[model samples]
Target: MDWTALWLSMRLAAWTVAILLPISVLMGRFLAYRQFRAKGMVEALVMLPLVLPPTVFGFYLLVAFGRNSPVGDLWQGLFGHQLVFSFEGLVVASVIFNLPFAVQPAQRGFEAIPVEVREAASCCGMSPLASLWKVELPLAWPGLMTAMVLTFAHTLGEFGIVLMVGGSIPGETKTIAISIYDKVQGFDDRSAGIMSAVLVAISLFTIALTYWLSARMGRRLS
Candidate 1:
């Protein structure tokens, strides 16, 4: 098994989850509270990753971040490099690809907060941010944990989008999922199986840990 690929995948998943968590909390809160025209359309757009093919999403990202495109040009001019075929590129792809897993769970968790409680907090003059930090967030811990676990798991298994944007550059853009694909293509079944088993074990352990921690915390809160 390629230990480098294994390490890269773990790194990517960790970073993706870390980045997604705060954004997910914000987006989730917005979706749960904000009301405006075209809100449904906006939600659909955010969820496009789930419905659209990963390749299609990856293609769009490639175009948007590739050299000669406006954002890409700006990025290159400022940073002195292109986003394509790099670790940053893979991270960008994974974030877009696994966003819904984080957002949806967070939204649901926030929604589970009773409306009257927010109203009561407002009656006491607590600002929206204060209420969110002191009241809403504490009640939504379980859902947030679910979001973190799901997002991490989803990112760990990401393939099509990462492959398209990252192009399998070893120790740079090659994640374990892509590495497993390379092993199969090379007829290295033993290595692929080893990596696959490792991924499966990690996923299972993460999910189990999330559940256990959440339950234990809930009991303590009770």
Candidate 2:
């Protein structure tokens, strides 16, 4: 197995979760509590990545972040390097691509909060921020945890977008998934098999843990 690549994938997953967690919380809480125009449209946009093919999404991202594009140019000016084919580019792509996974569960969790509970929080003179931290987050822990796990797992497994945006540069952007592809292309079945098995094990563990948390914490909340 490519240890370096495996490490890179973990790093990428960590960065994605760290970046996406708060965004998911804020957006998910808003969508859960607020009603406004084009709400369905906004929710649909968030869910778009779930159905969109990875390669297609990656292609659009490639163009959007390419050297000639405004985003790319601005990033280049600010960072002194092209955005595409870099590790930072991969993290940005992973966060965007994993939006639904992180947001949907969080939204559900926030929505599950009882109106009376919130009213009571306000009655007790808790600020919105304090209510979010002390009341809402504890109640919504399971969903938030699920979102974080899903984002981390998806980032580890993501292939097409990672490849398109951040090409296989070892120790930089060559994540484990890309490393597995490289191993296979090079006819190194043994290494590929090892890497695939590792991923499968991690995925199973995360998924099962998600279900467990949802069940156990969900029951306590009830």
Candidate 3:
């Protein structure tokens, strides 16, 4: 097995989760508690990555963040390197692509919190932030855990966007999925098989955890 690629994939997943967690919490809470116009449209935009073809999404990301693009130029000016084919680029792409996975469950978690509970927190002189940290989060942890687990596992197995945007730079952008593909292309079946099995195991665990969390959340809400 290409341990380096595995490590790189893990690192990328971690970064993606770290960057998305707070954003997920905020966005999820907003979507859960608020009734606003065009909410469905907002949700559709978030879910777009899940449905969109990875190759098409990656092409858009490449064009939007390429050296000639404004965002790319700005990043290059500050970072002294191009965003495309870099680890940072992969992190950014992963975060965007995994938005629905992270946000949707968090929304469900936050939605599980009863309005009366939030009102009671406020009546007890709790600030919005305090209510969120002390009252809301505890009640919604299972859903949030499901979100993070899904995001982490999905990030590990994601191949198209990473390949398109970051390429196969060893120890940099060559994630486990890409490594498996490379091994297969090189006719290294043993290595590919090992990595594939590892990913399959991770995916199974993720799904199991998600189901358990969903059940717990349902019971809590019920």
Q: Per-residue lDDT of 1-222 in model 3, one digit per residue for the tens?
A: 999999999999999999999989999999999998999999999999999999999999999999899999999999999999999999999999999999999999999888999999999999999998989998888878888998999999999999999999999999999999999999999999999999898789878977887787779757
Which model, 1 or 3, shows the larger TM-score? 1
Clashing pairs in model 3, backbone N/Cα/C closer than 3 A = none
Question: What is each predicted model's overall lDDT from 0 to 1?
Answer: 0.89, 0.93, 0.94
How high is each candidate's TM-score? 0.95, 0.95, 0.93
- Which ranges of candidate 3 are over 4 A from the true structure? 205-222
Lowest lDDT 10-mer window, candidate 1? 71-80
Relative to the true structure, candidate 1 reaches a TM of: 0.95
Candidate 1 lDDT score relative to the true structure: 0.89
Candidate 3 local distance difference test against the native: 0.94
Error of 2 at 52 (Å): 1.2
lDDT of 2 by residue, 1-222 (tens): 999998899999999999999999999999999999989999999999999999999999999999999999999999999899999999999999999999999999899899899989989999999999999999878879989999999999999889888988999899999999999999999999999999999889988988997798878877
Q: Enumerate clash totals for all models, in the order shown.
A: 0, 0, 0
